[model samples]
Target chain A: MHAPADPAPLPGDRRHPGWIAWALLAPMVFWLAAFVVVPAAILLVYSFCERDEVGGVVFRFTLENYQRVFDPVYLRIFARSIGYAALTTAICVVVGYPVAYTIARASEVWRHRLLLLVMVPFWTSFLIRTYAWITILKQEGLLNGFLQAMHAGGGPFNLLYTPAAVVIGLVYAYLPFMILPIYGSAEKLDNSLIEAAYDLGAGPVRAFSAVIVPLTMPGIAAGTLLVFVPAIGMFAITDLMGGAKVPMIGNVIQNQFLQARNWPFGAALGVVFMLMFVVTYGLLQRRGARLAG
Target chain B: MIEIRGVTKRFGSFTAVDNLSLSVRAGEFLTLLGPSGCGKTTLLRLLAGFEMPDEGVILLDGQDVSHLPPYRRSVNQVFQSYALFPHLSVRDNVGFGLRMQNVPAPEAAARVAEALEMVSLREQADRLPHQLSGGQRQRVALARAIVCRPKVLLLDEPLSALDAKLRHNMQLELKHLQRRLGLTFVFVTHDQEEALTMSDRIAIIHRGRIEQLGAAGEIYHRPRTPFAADFIGQANLLQVAVVGRNGTTARVRVGGGLELTVASAELPAGARTALVSIRPEKICISKQRLDTENLFEATIEEEIFQGATDQLRLVTTQGTRLHALVANESAMQEAFHEGDRVYCGLHLDDLVIVQAE
Candidate 1:
């Protein structure tokens, strides 16, 4: 992991009061404690507790909730969730890299305009945007209408409630995350190094693979984390796009809390999902570190 | 091995490399020496095929490679920033060219090892670029470029980033390597001392044109233009009007009253006014009367104690101000101070008339 981006210390700054540093750090510490640490602690406690018949939690400790998380039914959902997230991440990379690189290499005025276009979708609510996709992919939607108007073979395909629709929604929602980070990396890449590669007898393909790709790997890694971790836990897109037919791990956990009213089991599933994210993140960080080394 | 014929490159409205033609002899260390933005780097880029010329043909070993890309041409460049691949190990960086060329794996490895050995960076071959210091990184850049074994190697101020001691050592090492490999090197630098020390022939560039190109000693002692004379070393330029023309030397009037004779070989034809270049170190200041033909009495206006010499600023009686650098040995004996009158002698051979800029 990179070091925190603290500003360089000015000379003779040690004479300031000791409380100043604490004052500067107070807000961030309070935010993490209140939102991140407190929620995780509550989840951990609830994962070990038993739930009552009416969805109320019991004070007695038990291992039943944890045992339920390891069952084959949830494990299969977990594997499918990982599969969909990985597929989404791979598709995002293949589609986003060229767009990011083009924007990074564009002229200064055009670069900012293009980046603004990339972020314009975030101005609207995410659920509204997902609804917009549902409109486009549903039967008699704009896409099918266009296809029918063109007299294309195969009438009104059932594309709205499929696994492909879910993957498409996931990729569309998280593609900008991939683009922004890779653009940051590509913009900072030195031009002369590319020239040096060409000067050393590398063609366009070889120079890109040997020089440009490696130089921008950090941004690619960061983008992967940003898209992959959250994608695995996303429930709304899978529910709306898959019509709740294909229950991912996220859909299962959501069902446990609301439809099934098993609060302790949902807490156990949430804790396990959080652990998977931590493990995946750790593995990615290790790979990034080795690549850099 | 390379010939640049009337190459002209323009960026938008600004002409970077003007209609300039130059030729590089095979197996010679030719340096493009000038201050920054004088189009020296542009010329090097043109020869390396990084930037195509707008109006000329670049022939590499009798082949017209002007329109070809850098990879198709047999030329490599060591960039000013070193440009070492930060993500790759030194070995991989050096082997990048061979890999691109589809060289066999075992042969590529041996050549990479040989290149690393040449740079004496064998131990650091497996380390990434950031793991090495500036000098080692510089050597890695050198090895990476040379491993391709190109017909010409373009070095764009490759030593500018190193510390003084390391830069000096690298200069010697580079010259030795060039000789050992018998490869043509077209190096560029703004440092005159570095140019004088490392170049087999220095092309003194000014305003996208070569002001003078010759051997180091020749360019230093016999500069053809006023810019060449002043840029190579410290020279006191005197504006003089041509008074009379002799067989080979011409009598010129300095300022208003002082008169001197200088060789007119380098002077532009039919020029009524010319600039004479007098190297300060060649100016002799003596307390005793000297028998030189071009001798004048001058008062010392200022004296600066340099480490090896005393820099004396003198104003002639006829209102010609001149700077003289006298050896510390004689300067100590004479102990010339400000306001002291002294005799300044200018040898006829030392006074050269050069073309005005």
Candidate 2:
């Protein structure tokens, strides 16, 4: 038998001379240094420093900011933020999978049209869309007005400025992120594999659970990360939809930076939040690779 | 036993299978042999219940299953691409059908092991489909389908994906396995040689219809239609003018006004235009004139050196071309070269009259 050949190198693998690669990557390197590396370095320095009485960061080295981030009040906010993000991710998956599968299995023309519908929301500004949701969900908004006009029992129930409204806003904003990746996986799934399952006497449910689910796990994983990571740090939606009534980790971090005027404490919270994302993403990536293998 | 009666399947404007009817005997290996788009694969899919026939009934052992879903059918298929579940181990794939049937764990394991052993793949039972070679994956697919032990097994050109030599080996292995299992097989293929070597009976399909169906020997030796004659094997289908009919034979005038007699039970009554099929190997080429009534002098146009035989392209004096194959057993006996003048002899029993259409 012939030995298995080595896998071909990925496109990102550097095959050119060192100088040429550095030249090609110069612009991206400069951008990352200016935007990402520089900001991260500044945040790291601020996290370990002291804040002056007037809210300007002092040069004296200190660890009190990191200690203050783990206090009960801030920890509770972090937990609530995770709870909301986790719930949003779960609902997105439950709602997005069937829509993605339907679009993937549609004929070529319809598939394009449905995908366009999914993406059309992204063309407008996100903040404008959130304001639009505010218009619809507020008391005496279109939905409550229509219900009252139809003589429904409940009149002007508190719909906006609630946790449910926050979730609705998050789901609306991140649904396409959940769908597009799953659509990609579902579209490439071989129809013959499903037929083979049926031929082997598997019922529709069993075939889907056993064969289809494992194959599309990569897409689900990617969608989960995309929906979960950004939703955790989203402060604008809670302020607009939840009316800033309840504080999430994002609101606390934002208040420290702007309202409370404590840049060091805010930088500490940001560093911890960034570390949590790295750990979660690393674990998810390992699990995804295992599923694919 | 499987019966497909007057089944018709249409895709939009194209009729994939048109009023086709066929019966497969129990425990026999029957092949649907045809070129691509001739509805052979579509017919196999109909039997497998992957496609429902638009117009007829498919009976499995006397029960009509025309509208039954594939999971409810008693037929299994080995797809051309193998279609093995990539996430499952070979053992799991082979046991999937049994698991669906709710077989006991111990029994399913034993049966899966036996099936893997039958395919000589027990050692690789733990490997995933991606880890296996192409031939091994094909064997896993075979084992997976057969482990279910359905009444009829449909193979849709399963060997077409392999290389030539591997396909040859798998053909013999599959034929042997079918005999040992004593299960009915409805195999579909476009390879004529594979059909001839592996099938107990061959059905030649053309344009969504069966032109001929018989044993391999009968199909090769006495093809009833010009399509079957030209498709199954290499044949020189000469257009002949019928001179007269005598009993079951007819005398026809062929190339360069050369008169020949052929079997004519298939010819239409009072037909003047006829076609006769003659295998190249049946024609004899000699330097000296043979003492036969069916002999004509021709000049060799080209000599093609096949591995086991020499093919000579001969043209009669009146410019009618004929091909003759001489076995290369002896150098002296097969010494015909290009441009050499020779006499070509034809036997009465070697010619078959076929329909032009």
Candidate 3:
């Protein structure tokens, strides 16, 4: 209603055609269409098709691939993946909230120092960090070595190639991602609002719950998305730390691509994974917008 | 009653508050008035237990509550920015303190309702703080503080953020609310007008020390220090000569060699320098000379129209400047233009001789 009155554009300025702008941006548009949109189309098409003995996708319509996704084995793996991601999101929240709050509330010199500490671990390659954990948790690795040096150690521990190690690696890798977002949220939080909470009779615990948590909810949502979504399709951490002993859906789909030579099933999994992301993210966004409102 | 004794706060080398001692009487509305960076807010924070005094003790009802946290202290502050909780509905914000003390749901709700009604914000209970107007939010903040019924209510310039019209209205509203509740209010502000209107007693702070503390009327009509006279109200601080001294009253000479009778217990004579405090409102403006004892001729140097009143800045023939306030719109309508000659006189009780030899 209060928009400043802008002058009319000159007739000469109309020479910049809309289609020329689109043509200038064609590369990025086509790249998304090919890499993201086209692959999604292929997955959508393949989800309804049958597969041949040689693993080529036969373009005959069928509901069998989606039905296979709901089978007991795949269903169990899907449930397990959700449970792991949910637990990872919850733990990241419980652990990261305080770290972010501390960093945000620290002195200016220490605030940057703490935020830098949270980010510095990312200087090395992410895969290398996960692999480094594999070396540490191996049968005769540093943990067992330290345990043995204490003199009352038992035989070599079978910690390697377990779900626990995968969970540990996932948490360690995603903790920084979680912290940065929560920290951004906490940093923007008004100090006066917190002081007001104290004046209102909120003891430390109630203040954090009713005021601090709700105020920083956007950061929690961002951190949850940053940690949970990546945790779903994680392969390297599970393959190295979980020792390929148990078949997670990530490894299952990886096997179809490399070992089993089944392009159709991999395409089917790709389509389902992308759909899960779309649905989960859509629900998350709507919920976030509602809370923000 | 609230007492602050020898309290000091320092952050590294910057001493925000120096050793300061003051007390607020029960059911009294006292303001800590000073300019910005004068430690009024710091003193308020020390009383609220937000910041601990590095040197001395704070007592509430003769009990040392210095080391206690803000939550443990029986005091509430209406923050300068009207720091209402953005996330909660107004009802929840007002009920926050009650909920913390484990007050039952029904009782806490009743108190919240009463407090909201006290601030005339009962209809805004469902709205969030951001949804309300600035004045409404300020009231919600006030309601939140008084809902707890703390022994002491500290207001840190709660109306400073408001627009001029709203601030003026809220001042009267807050004064009425404070008197009705009979709760001790420790108000802080840099605005002298706000201090004069709402305060039962005004403690004028300067450089972390109290320059003067007395009844509003006493502080305004008879300020003892030059700083207090200048800071608390726009006073004309001019040099005067001590012509002679009786038992209590001293005869002083202003520019143009005009003598004015000023109250002084006793003072030495043969002195050329003396401090005189005269409020702009007390000086009478005349187009012709009057039968007044202290009168001088001056030309208008500046004429400022402030709606109902006009402020006239005059310079005497002896080159001493004085400010005069004319209350009538007709006085302003027919007022002398800049450079017009006029006779001005000062009332005997209106002048306070701050320092005399």
The residue ranges of model 1 lying beyond 4 angstroms of the native Cα positions read A1-19, B267-270, B330-333
- Model 3 CA lDDT for position B104: 96
Q: DockQ, in order, for the candidates?
A: 0.44, 0.50, 0.35
Instruction: In angstroms, give how far residue B203 of model 1 lies from its true place.
Output: 1.6
Model 2 - which docking category?
medium
Best by TM-score: 2
Summarize candidate 3's per-residue lDDT along A1-293 as a digit string, tens digits. 11122333333455555988999999999999999888788878877888788778788998777777778998788778778777878889889889999999999999998888998888999888887887888988988787788875575787778888878887898898899999999999989888777766677887888888989988988898889887888877888888877667788788887888666677677677777888888887897887664
Q: Please state every model's RMSD to the true fold in angstroms.
A: 4.3, 2.5, 5.1
TM-score of each: 0.94, 0.95, 0.91
Model 2 residue runs over 4 Å out of place are A1-22, B264-268, B291-293
lDDT of 1 by residue, B96-212 (tens): 889988899999999999999898888888888887778888888999999999899999999999889788888999999999999999999999999999899999988888889
Clash pairs of candidate 2? none
Q: What residue pairs are clashing in model 1?
A: none
